[model samples]
Target chain A: MTAQIIPSRTAAEAALAEIFASAKAGLPGSGAVEKLREESFAAFARGGLPHRRIESWHYTDLRALMREALPIAPAPTRERRAALRKAAAALPANSLVLVDGVFAAELSGKLPEGVKVTSLSAALAEDRPGILESLAAAWAEADDAIVSLNAALMRDGVVIDVAPGASLAAPLHIVYASVAEKPAARFSRSLVKVGAGACLRLNEMSLGAGGRAGQTNNALIVDVGEGAEVGHTLSLTDTRPGSLRLETFLVRVAARAKFDSFALVTGGGLMRRQIFKLFAGPDAKGTLRGVSLLRGREHADTTLFVRHAATGCEGRQAFRYILDEESTGVFQGKVVVEPGAQKTDGKMLAKAIMLSDAATMNSRPELEIFADDVICGHGATCGGLNADQLFYLETRGLPPPEAEALLLEAFANELIDDIGHADLVAAYRAEVAAWLAARARSETRSVA
Target chain B: MLEIKNLNVAIGGRRILNDLDLKVAAGEVAAIMGPNGSGKSTLAYVIAGKEDYEVLSGEVLLDGENVLELSPDERAAKGLFLAFQYPVEIPGVATMTFLKAALNAQRKQRGEEELSIPEFMKRVKKAGDMLDIKPEMLRRALNVGFSGGEKKRMDIMQMALLEPRFAILDETDSGLDIDAVRIVADGVNALRSRQRGFLVITHYPRLLEHIVPDTVHVMAGGRIVRSGGKELASELERTGYREYAEEAA
Candidate 1:
């Protein structure tokens, strides 16, 4: 008789098994959706949590980093929702709120004409046509264990749809806030569909209450229709020291469509934000940009996979990171041009500035081109702040910290200044200023 | 107003200046002319307190106060300035914002009230006009994409705005046309006062024709090999630095 060898389960795998067993029966969807969930969970179980063996996850070893997983978070109470509403009162009227992964109708206000917003769970419960299909369309293409885990465990999210040939006057802001007192996990997924000849502006934000080790696993899938224009901005701010966040974005741009995205990651304990952008049709254009500010033992990773599958398409990416204290920043970007993708142009650049002796940065920019007549290039640079520049500012009568702040602002402003929206630029500049002020205050505290 | 006594400086473990002694009195412009590799720039950097240069032994006194113990900004607050040979370009910091910040920082350090926006703007406009610097250039990033002449003019404009008590011009005339040099010299002359001192470092005597230094020093090897009036610049231009180089060797 041959002995059968069964691999032992890791803590993450065991935790997933327990969560899936408890939530599967109560989860939305049946038939195809149910089968997709089962298959995705089985796939996740087969591979377990992604570790160093996976090339994409090499820099971020989730198996070792995420040693323990917290239990699923419960829905926020009425009082909690009220407090969240009060706190988020500063947001624009055309905004939606997601508390602890569940879409809060009480917190959401009226939307403009020609725009429809609904909860994912509600759509699944009512068996809305094409809802399950849209959710399952990108499941197999994600090709990451963390994404598969999100697909298996995602309970609630929002579905935003813009009518054909329509345009929204104001940006649609979606705020995700975690208000759990104890350590917990929240899984959410959002799907956005911009119709043909339509235009939409989508803004997303993630925030966590201080003093708790919370886990947030979020995913977004965006489909840009033919000749549509979509602008998306994501901001992650004020996360707790023990928070772990993993976000994935799957974007597909159609013929003559335009997709513009910018993400600012300023606060987190452990974060890995991955973006998969595919130019699926001819003459499509995409610009993906990001800036990350890390400090105090934080580890942040931004990985991108830009694929040009059609001819006459162009893609550009620029990412910059500012790391301080003992923090670690990572950037892994790949531009791939498939066969027959002639006249494709792709460019990528990643730069980092280390502010302390213990700070570390890892950047890898790669290009894989199979087409004969295509242009693709990438560059990465990692270095400390220029000593001569600092000296120049110092000699002009500014103190050391103030001079450093000015230089760092200048470094980040190159990207921030290109943002087309004036309001968004101002908002991001304020956030940067706040972060620098906080850093200066912390330095003073440590010195004292 | 500015004095360097027995100054010894080494950079990267190599002696660049040895027992250098010089002084610039109030209202006087002292010019240092030297050949390549003569440690002229090192003296300017040491006076400004650049971090990499090791000051083994020195007493840099400004108005009877030892300035060697101060940081670069502290030295600036005490009214000292150094115009760089190669001005550093900061890509996103606007020149106007930098000027305002610098002027306000110095004023605050000296316990003076900050200038109002209109007042600061008027001052900058006057200084810009004097230096022939367009207002649009002031709105651009500091030194980024500036031509050689523009960069030199910008340095002179900064000096005009700051109005320091002691100024050191390190090769400010290196990358300039005749017109630019004249404009820069005119800007410096406009700021000249009895309480202010100037130390001009150059390789050629062409700049001395415009600034008209009271004292000229020929530096070779590490220390001053010759010191005389403005006539010394013309003499060096006629005979070249060969004799001074041989004498120092």
Candidate 2:
């Protein structure tokens, strides 16, 4: 299969091959990583593309979308630049911007003390300890054409790790910004490690004012350590129709460690966010929550897989989506309790509120348990506002339109309040209200 | 100031209120005493212009304006308020915010300017104090995690804030203790005036004790079967709705 592929004449793929040659020059990582890359490239050559039949990529069929290879476009010139910097202003970091899978060092900011913000190429060139092998082995799937393309073509993706027990106040931010020109595909990854009792706040802003057709972005990793606390917040809003496919990998919560992630998807052409959090240590816990607001033909998919490998671990996942117009929403969540994971408690709630007949929501919640002593539950609700509830509000003198707003606000408000950050909650409420207003206005216009 | 002529209402094709007739003039506090399933709530809701009641036939005239054609918000603009028996809570929306929105909505409909934030706050603060409601409760989400008594208090507070020309109290005393009932009663009484009318719906006469009414109507079989003065409520309290239920059957 490997020999059957790898020889294709396309402008982008040929350029990717050249970039691969440059990335291989003076690579710093050991022969172990070189062999992994060789195997991954070979697998990618053979597999060619992943189809919808692939169970893991059922919701996101990357094979059909990647029919033509889209290589990393070069960085912006001084006079003509995209809004990458403006979109990433919220994340405080030794910030790095990857445009079309290639890094722009000039666009990145300075790193803080004891923090090294450099490209994967630089890390490999320097043979950085604990940087290359773990992620390459764990996250790099040889068959994923996109991840493989990222590995084969990505010149710079920020890699930061905290030495054992070393704490830093500022986080290392990885910003993914897109601009509309041809088919844009970018593969990016971030490997973060925290020390015992250390804390970090990673903020990712997936933003763009507008884009043309054929736009794709894929991101793969983030880690929180034992006794460490990490808070991750992402606000993703795209202009026009584009696709955002991201896989978040989380491991390492020693006893008493904590991880909290709050993801907000304002609107995208199509967004599928997968978060796989593995709680392997006793009392190692985490909370994951997301809100995806969609309108137009935009679609948002949030898939979560949380595994409780140790006893006395607590995990929670709650996500709310408001789909209007002809938009589609999908949520698939699973909480698995392995054997001997006694006292493992988990809860997940996925809710989708549709405002129009064309709006559709698909939700599935699964639980697998081997432990006799555990409490795990998952529930999903898909519907319009309640008739009794709407009548109740209308009876209070709210118009039918305002009544819908009140109900949706009431629904999303449930999760918004649980967001620990007050400022973030306030901002998110405004986002929800704005989306509702826009949806209401557009819907009214169409009705009229 | 309010009149319902030949009112008929149905829920999912089942008639709940059939050809109901009632009237409430200015300065009237009319008590509607009814047994279970007597469509007391249906009457309150239909008159308040709630959706799904399916008013099959009727003319609801509020101060000579045909209200059956108007939205509930429009009725509210015309000075009609329905104190929900079980008020629907709206989380993330503060009580003060709702009050402000409602107040401004009514004012705008009346061609009046919106109250400044400070002015609105002062007005709410007055009602909060008059109703003995904690100021903190106003800051919280509307009735979220509120006690039964507090929810009713919130309803009264909103009623006081809107200051409608007519109001419907739908079993507002169902879940209140004596003290909370007194507070709600006092709040309702404070809004009472010679030009404002109120229709108080209750199954228990306990509420009438706190807020005395001018007249009491016994609703049986979805219609008002008997009419009398305040003494009628006391009579029903002495004798349960069994007599009305027997007659209804």
Candidate 3:
């Protein structure tokens, strides 16, 4: 397994320390939360940003991916901000629109009944301190550098609360559209707190629309309450078709909570680290499915971490990628079982199909277990379509190119078939098939 | 007519077929009985234009045209078909959709319009029934997860749909039971016409009894060293390719 993260950023480090110092100096609190934040900030100061040396962040080299200057906070133009509204409107569910790391309330649609949606800004104004404090407590340790950096850079996000016994008819779609110039990195933070026995379906669309700098990143945090079920599907990519994006999603499930997530990635010039996480609670379920179809200079990275912290919880992750031309893909999934988290079942598999020699894929699937009674496994496979299989199709008279596309489609079909929603599955299948067909045509044209 | 004249082939720098020769007239079925490594399957693949099954020498002529210049689909459009012994189990390529594509491709090459969904369904249903394959089989990925017999039957069903002028059955009877063999043989017999030819390649001679060939050739050491009437199959059935292989060497 190759490690891609390294830490040596003095400039970014100085910026982080100043941000933490301000956060400590201007503590917002009604109770002991201020002291906790001070302590977490101190830990952050000591640990600094996590490098690849830390086992948790093996594949995604955040330090290298950051490259040049981190774009300072800036308001994207109103003209370009239309993409946020447009994406939100296309969704068939209640939407929370966030533009350039800031939520646009008047631009968003009406919230569904029994759904309590509040901006992070509004929640802080009322001094409901525990919600924000608990978030820092659960996800960040001053020792956890990335979480602290996110905390320091955190801006406007939506907080969704589902009342007890409520089940949403339509899934909630949170559209985060980045309007910043090229290299615009939008830090989008979302916290979903579902009440016990509540069921919710959420769709997330992460778009780096028309950004010049070529990269945008968003961070989302979701917590499924006890016995609540949440399904989140993300159609993630950049608007410019050849732009790069870095996104991180942190999801936590409570006792009896169920979480299902699907990520369909296309058209990112350089995509880094869309992470799926399940901080296990008793009987909690987490299933992650992702597919990245990239061509040209596009790059997609899917990294998953599922910590089995409670007993009888299930964690499953599957990611497949198709890369043509000079596109690149990276998939790294790790499943960890804490001691006494027995009966924790986990399965992670990463499969990649490279259509051209110029395209590249890096995959590492690993399992860490401390509990003896757990059933945990991981698999990673990378290759082109099987010649024997293709020959079989060819003899059936599907030419080589068509046969190759059919086999690649079949690779994604396995994951698509597992998606419970029929219509959504069909749409994704059609989209992926078309993407593969276009590549097939291009290759054939070049050959001819 | 299909003819192989001094066909020489190799794979990964090693010779598999050397100076091979055979012929099958239109409307006639010829059975090639050979032992493992006798290049029977290699011959079929070379004719079908499988990647890396290079033609080092000799020529394969179909209807008086050298076939070595054609691609797989081109060969198929030119009235040549090779029924793979080990049918690929493609996961997403629906059996019926693939059949339609193959059929339509051949039709388009012949200047005919593509089949509509309804027309395709009707034709596939008839062909499926003739091969004793259920309609559900057509809905599934082409031959994926199918039994060996089912895979062979699906191959025959596709062959029936294409209705090519020449067909090569490479061990189509290798994995089938007596009943599946009979059903497959009956389907092929039903589709036989004076304008088409078939070269059935198999290790065992049992298949020749039902699809009784017009001629039998014993292939050994990559070439056919013996040819005779249909009764030759019974002789090889009692003995084996060992004698013929020794004679060829």
Candidate 4:
């Protein structure tokens, strides 16, 4: 008889399993969705947390890094919701706010015309037509344990629908805020649907207080309709030192449609942002760019899977990482050109700068071109700041800190400039500047 | 005024400068002419506090205060400037943005207020005109994709804007055509004042013809072998550096 031995689970894995078992019945979703959750949890439980052996999660061993999963946070109270509403009032008037992964309608703003917003939990409970199928289909090709866990536990998130041919002048903003004072966990999944010929700009912002130590798993699924133009930008700021965050961006671009997304991660304890994009129809264009500023033993990983599934499509993925202190950054990008995806033009580049002796960066850019008549390439570069450039700037009277900041800014600006929208560009720039300023202040304090 | 006393420098344990003593008085344009491998560029870099070389034993003084202890930017705040032979290309940093940052940083260090945008632009325009640095060039990334001549011209423009008390032009004419050298020389001459000092490092005598130096020093084997008037440059051009090399040996 052959012995069937199971590997031991990490503390986090055990905690996650117990939490799921205790909360499964109360989790928002109908019968089918509940069954899917059970199946997804089974899959996750069988695999355990992603470890170094898993090729996709090679650089980030969640099993080892995640010591224990905190209990899932309950919905915010009235006072917390009121505080969030007051805070939301300070934001732009077109924002939808979520607190601890749960939708807070009172804290949200008035969305633009022709736009319908619903809570994802509500959509799941009501068994809204096509919601279950769409949610189940996202990242279906990749058996990612984290995504499955999120699917099994996702409580609430904003679901946005833009009508066909509707053109919105201002960008719709979605703010995911974590306000827990103690250790906790939040799982949220947002879905965005843009109708054919529609134009939409969506900006997602993630904010957490510096004192809160928690775990957050968030996913954003976007479907760009035929001939639609969509731009999405995500900015994550003020991450605490003991926190952990994993975000997923799953996108599909349709025929002749254009989809562009940029993510700027300034501060995080341990962060992994994974992107899965598919060129679903011919002549669609997809561009993904990101910049990560990491320091203080923080680790940030960006993994991408871009599939050119149709002919005449174009895809570009570029990312930059600036690491300081003992921080580590990882970029693993894979581009797949399908057999029938002829004339597919795709390029991927990852660049990193190590600002200290201990900073580390791992870059792996892979291209799988099954199609013979396609153009695909990938490149990676990792280095320290140019000494000559620093000397040149110093001779021009800029101090070392300022010179370094300027160089880092210039390094990230290449991708930031490609964001296209002027106001959004300014906002992103301001955030970059703010991060630089904080670094400078801390450096000064350390020196003193 | 800038002074180097018994400046002995080395890199990777190999001596590059040996007891090199030189001075550039305020209002004087002193030229250092040297053969290849004579450490002229090393001297310029050492004075500017570039971290590559080891200062075995020396003192770099600006206004009688030792500057070897100061950082490169601190020395710049003290009105020291080095025009690189090969200006570094900093991608994505617009020329205008760099200029403003440099100028304002220096000003702030001197306890002076920053220039207004209009005033800063006016100064850039006036200085850039002398160097023929087009407005569009200033809009592009700093020195990125600039022709060799354009990079040198931009260096000269930065020199003009910063208005340092001591300026060292390290092979500023190396890759320039005659016209470019003339334009850059004109920019340097326009910035000359009694409060300013200049140290021009070059191998050939061509640039000296345009910006005539008040004093010329022939550097060989890391030390100044001969010091003379402007005629010395022409003499070196005619005699070549072989004799000086043999003399220093």
Top-lDDT structure, candidate number:
4
What tens digits encode model 1's per-residue C-alpha lDDT throughout B1-249? 899999999999999998999989999999999999899999999999899999999899999898999999999999999999999999989898899989999999999999999999999999999999998999999999999989989988999889999999999999799998999999988988888999999999999999999999999998998899999999988999998788777
Candidate 2, residue A35: how far the Cα is off, in Å: 3.4
DockQ, in order, for the candidates?
A: 0.81, 0.56, 0.57, 0.81
Greater DockQ among 2 and 4 belongs to 4
| Candidate 4's iRMSD | 0.4
Mark the regions of model 3 whose C-alpha exceeds 4 Å error after superposition. A1-59, A70-88, A140-144, A181-183, A207-215, A239-244, A274-276, A441-448, B105-112
Chain A TM-score vs. truth, each candidate:
0.96, 0.83, 0.84, 0.97
> Which rank order by lDDT, best down to worst?
4, 1, 3, 2
Itemize residue pairs with steric clashes in candidate 2: A28-A124, A28-A125, A226-A254, B1-B25
Calculate the i-RMS of every candidate, to one decimal place.
0.5, 2.2, 1.8, 0.4
Chain B TM-score against the true chain B, candidate 2 = 0.97
Off by over 4 Å in 4: A207-211, B245-249
DockQ value for model 1: 0.81
Q: Lowest lDDT 10-mer window, candidate 3 chain A?
A: A23-32
In order of appearance, the predictions have TM-scores of 0.96, 0.90, 0.89, 0.94
Candidate 2 segments whose C-alpha is farther than 4 A from its true place: A1-34, A44-48, A64-68, A82-96, A101-116, A140-153, A163-173, A179-181, A207-214, A247-251
Clashing residue pairs in candidate 3 (N, C-alpha, C atoms within 3 angstroms): A5-A61, A43-A142, A44-A142, A182-A212, A182-A213, A183-A213, A183-A214, A243-A269, A244-A270
Sort the candidates on DockQ, descending order: 1, 4, 3, 2
When summed lDDT is taken over every stretch of 10 residues in candidate 4 chain B, the lowest stretch is B240-249
Model 2 TM-score, 2 decimals:
0.90
